[model samples]
Target: MTSAKSSENKQAFINGWKQSKLVRVFLYFILMLVFFLSSYQHLIVSDKNMGENTSEKEINQETPIYSEYSINSLDFLEHIFDKLEQINLDATFTYEEKTEIYKLYFLEEYNKFVEDNIKTMQQSEDSLDAAFIQEIENQLIDQQYDFPVEAFFKLPRLSQAEIIKMSAVAESIVKNLMKEQIKEADIMRGKVAEMVNASNLSDDDSRVLVTEIARFSIFPNYFYDAAATKEALSSTKTTETNYLQVVGLILLVILFVVFLYMYIKQSNLQIRNNNVQLLMLVFIFIINMMGMKIVALGHSLDYPYLGFLAPVALGSMLIAILLDYKLAFISSILFSIFASIIFNFENQMFLFDYRYGIVASVICFTSIFAVHKASQRSSILKAGILITIAACTSITAIFLITNENVISNYIFSLTFALMNGLLTAVFVIGILPFFEAAFGILSPVKLVELSNPNHPLLRKLLTETPGTYHHSVMVANLSEAAAESIGANGLLCRVGSFYHDVGKTKRPNYFIENQVNSENPHDTIDPDLSKSIIISHARDGVEMLKEYKMPKAICDIAEQHHGTTLLKYFYFKAKKQQELTGELEEEVKESDFRYPGPKAQFKEAAIVGLCDCVEAAVRSLSNPKMDQINTMVDKIIKDRLEDQQLNECDLTLKEIDTIAKSLKETLLGIFHSRIEYPELPSRDKKGVTKDEATVSI
Candidate 1:
């Protein structure tokens, strides 16, 4: 007893929590937060490159100073060689003048090289080649030149052997000097060629010289600057400012809050009072957005719209099925907006990419439209197909209009779009039952399933109480039409009517509908006892429904169909018998003969009750005429109205009149008079004329 009480209290608290206004507000806020966080990474934290400083001076200043060493070594050597070669040895200038000029040029080149290298070393942190610099300084300081050009020119008038020997000695000295400063063999060879070509000697002697001067001079390309490259790469990475993004996020949040507020305001009270549907809506939205986010992260795909495969229409279909189309449409719009944000691969925060958004919106809207009247599970597949077609068509049209590569985009977009539909169908089939069970939603698909003749209770009614099953079927048909006319749930009326008389199956012989054995069980029983048996069916049906775990709405219809009306047939019989027994003064309470009921609390249940009576009354008529059908439907509706059976429901007088007309037309069609048939010709024993024996037409 303690455990039971604790469990009851826990359930009550849960119910209270679910219905609390503060809890609703908190849940709405949490949904808003989920919306914000789902797109935050894509919208705010992406690369912007706003803080980079691209000034030329900054780039040049940060350039590595060691690059100057490569320039100094190559340029200084070329300058010395160019000056030496430009000397006018064949002109009026003497050898001393050329030698002095050569010495001055060499000294200038050497001083410049040393100065540039020292400057480079000072500016560079730790990358300068110190050993190479020292070697250059020692070689330049130790080198001695003795003006061998004049000696060679004076001895050049001698034999070829002497010229060759002189040229060889001169070449030897220049090669030795060139090897001192230039470490690379290629640069050393070029320098030696320049030195040998500038010698004051004959053409043959110069040609026989070891070094040959090429027509063109080689200069070094710019050296790679490790520090400068590193600095440039680091500079490209900018520190993003969050002020604008924060503002944008705030604006978006405000917009979403306003939108959600309007949505809640326009929704039904049931939806407003229950947080399950609201949370389910938000959950579907978040799941789709998260799926899109995951897809967007793979930007490496060739087709930009390949991420359209995310089941954007899944939420729309679910909302349309589990709730209504208006909410589905609104949710689709919001989802499209978020999709645009997530698919904005360029990170244009406030700007939306309508290319994907439009496609998603169109697909979702089409799915909702297609599934708006869906009453079966297969309808979802139809909606999926419609969604896929919309997706592919919209995507293809956009690509065509925008002059994108149609062939490639179509290949990927079509595949993903088709998969989008198939996957949506799969997901809806898998998750719809969960939502229905969780939210206690009696969807049209569920109603259709329950209305099938093969249900356990329904089959039992067919086999055990076949007469009641037929009566229930007629009631279902009548109730479906009447409920539709009055804007009630016709499917609910039909399904509820099917199970309303299932209790009669337990005592088939006791009820008039199932007494096909030509025996009335009530004939031998007392009137009071007969009334009790008749009134017990309604309560029995309620208990049976509860035992079978049927939906509460159906159980209520089973219990309330007869309401608290007086069982006049049995009441009058008992009163007549009492009069014969000299107990006429004893009062018979009307309540004892009535079926126990809490009245019909909803329009569908009330309509089902009225249809049940109309069907039974019309079925009992030997030949139901149009006038009789009309009178019967009207009288049943009038009687129920007078009994206050419909007072608790929201059915208006105009709707009641409409239901009467629908029931009358449906019954008249069912029991319309047939044409009289002529008797078939029958031969007499003597095989006389058959026309004489046949009846007249």
Candidate 2:
């Protein structure tokens, strides 16, 4: 009991782990971090090229750094600009004012003129004082004159304040002249006008001037301001990466704790069969890998995130085939999350990217109904096309969620859905032979084709033992319908029925069914010997199928079809001859008349057994009707049930009834009659010669 409890607890832990959301989130977090680390080089390149002297302190101190840099630099330029602008408005009404302002231009010609004229005036009038003459010249410089204020009157002496003012005015004039000219209208300016700007020029000229000014201004401060702003906008001061790492570690701990809690909570849940569960997990993993590969391809295509949805639609039937519906639905959601990551969620042109989720869910859910008990290449292909339609519908519905151009999106999505279905069908078809060969997945279409009489063994039976071939075909039809009606493996049952009688191919002429134009082979052997030969076929078929490496399921059907039933025909024949010959004294034992032991232990095997009996019994009817066939079917089923041949199988009584009804319906349909021909005259009542009688027979 303790051992049982431990096993149960271990199983419960596995079950809980399989469904743990915390575990999934932890894994996703790790994947995200890995992706970020792998792509960090792009961030490095974007952050390069800062100025030399710009310290981190200066960067942090900058107020609204980006805005302050733009406006403050403009402020410094603005102060210099204000003085330059006033030069155009400056006015000088007197000679003093003219002297003051004219000195600002460094008027060397006017200064020499004033000094030479003053010396000449002193020589012309000796009585005039040299000091007085200079004073008079200075006085004349302070006077304003109209018209040709020539060298004498207009000339002025240079001074320190005037020199400073002259330099300031020259700088202001240069700054104003730098205003860019329009390149198109003012053709001399060229292409620079569109990119530069200043107040005095037209729009185009202003653009050129600003661009040229900026081109020449490569001072450190010019770049420092921009670099500071970019760094300020982009750089992280709080070290978010380290914080995320810590949170990730905490999440991992919580994930483990939740897993432990659930494992403890469900400590008694029973586990499914280990082999089937493992197969399911392996299949899911392969599918996951395929989906990942497809998502990677779509990422390369630069398709919308919806492109990742293709896998869910494509792999839906595979999920339904290997796993149950609920798991398939959950897998779709998981796949969608993976797709969103693959898409990068960066450039979604459409409003509702939910199409990926919708497409995945609809295809998966719809396929659950379409793929029930499906195990054939053609059926899987059909399921794939059905899933494609579901994808298209889901895409259309999602399109309505946003006002994207309908026909274009519809066409695009439809094409993708078709490609998904077709590719899935192709992949599934390619994998089928491998799975069937390796793991022995018996598909329905394969079973139907194998059941045909043209198969080598079946053909041998037809050529050398035609009666058994006919019997096997009837049995295949019967079992196929029975298997289908019960939701069992019908195709496997049908194929098993076809090859079940292969042993008769070995010594076909020894069986009574093969005695077409001769006396019965039974006549040449004792009843005991005939019974042994008949039963040997069962064992022989098992051996032959083993040699061919047929699946255990098919081999079981072949070996169990007879199910130790008595050889009534030979036993009764032996008893009648003994009584007729007055030799009743000889002993007749039941052991000599029985097949080797072991009954049918599965639905497919049991159905084959019933079919084997019903076919042989019904074939003897000269003019069988529905009632006769029903009676034969009823007898076969009743005998099998009474013998408890179906007890080990999972078939219920209601399913058996359904099978019986379906077989009756199918037989009636297959054997339905044509209209009768009218008769004109009759032959003699005693009838014809031996040749005619032979022909009729």
Candidate 3:
């Protein structure tokens, strides 16, 4: 039997998983893929140099080729060579010709280098500038110098023989003067060459430049060309932007497919009755979407971690109220990963910051526990307050690492903290009713409504059959105490007990306790017929509850309140009747005289069963005292305990003891007395009875 039961369970699990539509499962897979891929894309694009080198290569391939050199460097060299040639011209001439020679050569060299290098030069080309330097050298050598007496004696000029002599005269004053100028010019050339070498370099090697630009931009002393630096600076940004849009599209598709899967899966549930759960899933998806959008917006605005608040608040509340704690905790983890993507993406202040996740997790835990015990809408607000506090602490810890700009970060963190609380409260308020009404979930409010004495059926029971109404109230009280003491849901137990005897309303006069002024209907009837009437109530109540479209929880209570216990009283009474009537003995069975039930499988239902018996048995005692009530309560509990009626329930013996204590207290208070003050009658001054007597206190 155990093996068979295990096999049945395995099949049930397999069937549940198999029956889930293929399209929905496929969509889930797609969503997971997209989520991972988009997250990876975000990481790649954040590097700023993602495809820069490749882009540069593509550009280089399309552009025309040329010999690479800083023509300006070559031109400067040519000027120095021309100066050497002019100095040689005056060295062999008279002092009067020296100035004239120097002026002419200087003018010629300046114009030539300007035309060849500065005027026509482009910044980058195919090859190194080796040939350009050679051309400049050849140009300098091509310049002819005339020897003159005046140029030779000139202070700035030298004779051609002197220039040739100075070429070998490395220690000469003129050579030294020329060498210093050349050295200074060479230094400038080297600096410019360095900049040019870095110009079309790989983006991965551009970090030092970026850092320099960013650091120097903070002060006015740095001279960076706004136009020249613009293209390089914006290239990384453009690539990042393109990647983000692509990733966003992918993520959007993922979210849609996930939403569709959730919607369709909910739709396929035979128990869903309508698209209510589907609508709820859609709403949760929308909430998640809203959260993602907010995060994206926050990142765009350069404010990171701000978007983490909405999902944490909303997701926690959803898991707590709409689902179980375990599922809620799992979703919290998933949302935490999503939050990292949303809040701490490319523009994030911190990498892998645990603050958002920690805050969200705390909120999730608090929400689950808080709302689990929540009996009203106001209780969610309390839970929201707790979430807000946790969120604040989490965000503040995040801000501690980001304290470089304390004021702005502090304000940003606080904004999300406040939002977490507000959104949680709002989501709980909005989703509660839809779930309660559509799913027919037995919330505390529903229990309270059904427990009202003014309910139509309860009122009918009160008027037409006061004894049954009184009996139901007692049962409700006992069941509530029992359920509470056993860590079961007391309100549910109490409300179920109230409606358990509703079938007794149908034939009030036939039931012994309800037949106050009526003749005993069972007296003339055979014992078998009487047993049928007494035992039919359980079946009738179930049918009545079903007709009203009551929730399964309530219907279960109706069906299971009277398990499959034998009707010993009625069955024995029937046996005696059969013997007295001299009827032919028909086969009588114990099962035939029992309630057709799957039995109470939970503590609440079991408690209702005990309450049903205890109420009927206790109410029959006339003017019972505290000791008598205690004994009766104990006896009823003990009888059920001994009979193992509570076997199916998960209640412990300790819990049962607590239930007995709570019941005893409640019953004593209920049966407490009200004392009346007596007044003495006074006659007016005469022994004879007066027309009117005065009452004295």
lDDT values, one for every candidate: 0.70, 0.56, 0.58
Clashing pairs in 1: none
lDDT of 2 by residue, 238-307 (tens): 2454355446545543553354334423542111223333344345545654564555555434343446
Error of 2 at 2 (Å): 30
Model 2 / residue 624 / CA error / Å: 3.7
Worst 10 residues of 2 by lDDT: 180-189
Residue lDDT tens for model 3, 580-694: 8887568566677877765786778888887787667666778767898889989978977776677876677887888888777877777765665796555556653443533
Candidate 1 — what's its lDDT? 0.70
Counted clashes in each candidate structure: 0, 13, 25
Best by TM-score: 1
Best-to-worst order by lDDT is 1, 3, 2
Q: Lowest-scoring 10 consecutive residues by lDDT in candidate 3?
A: 50-59
Worst 10 residues of 1 by lDDT: 49-58
Off by more than 4 A, model 1: 1-34, 45-306, 406-410, 546-549, 582-587, 674-697
Candidate 1, residues 1-697, lDDT tens digits: the string is: 9998999799789777867888788777877787788666555332322112111111223333212233333344345344444453245557666556554554465566666755665566654445434543443344322223433343223344544444454545443443232223243333444445445554664444223222112222223334444444455332233446657886787688678768777764356777766677777776666677777767654343667788878888888887778888888888888888777753343457888789889998998888887888999988888888888899888878986432544677889899988888888878888877776677888888898888899989998988999999999999999988866788889999999998887778898887776889788999999998888899889899999888888998999888787889998888888878888576777778887787887788888888888898898999988988888877888888888888977788999999989998898889999988997667779875567646442
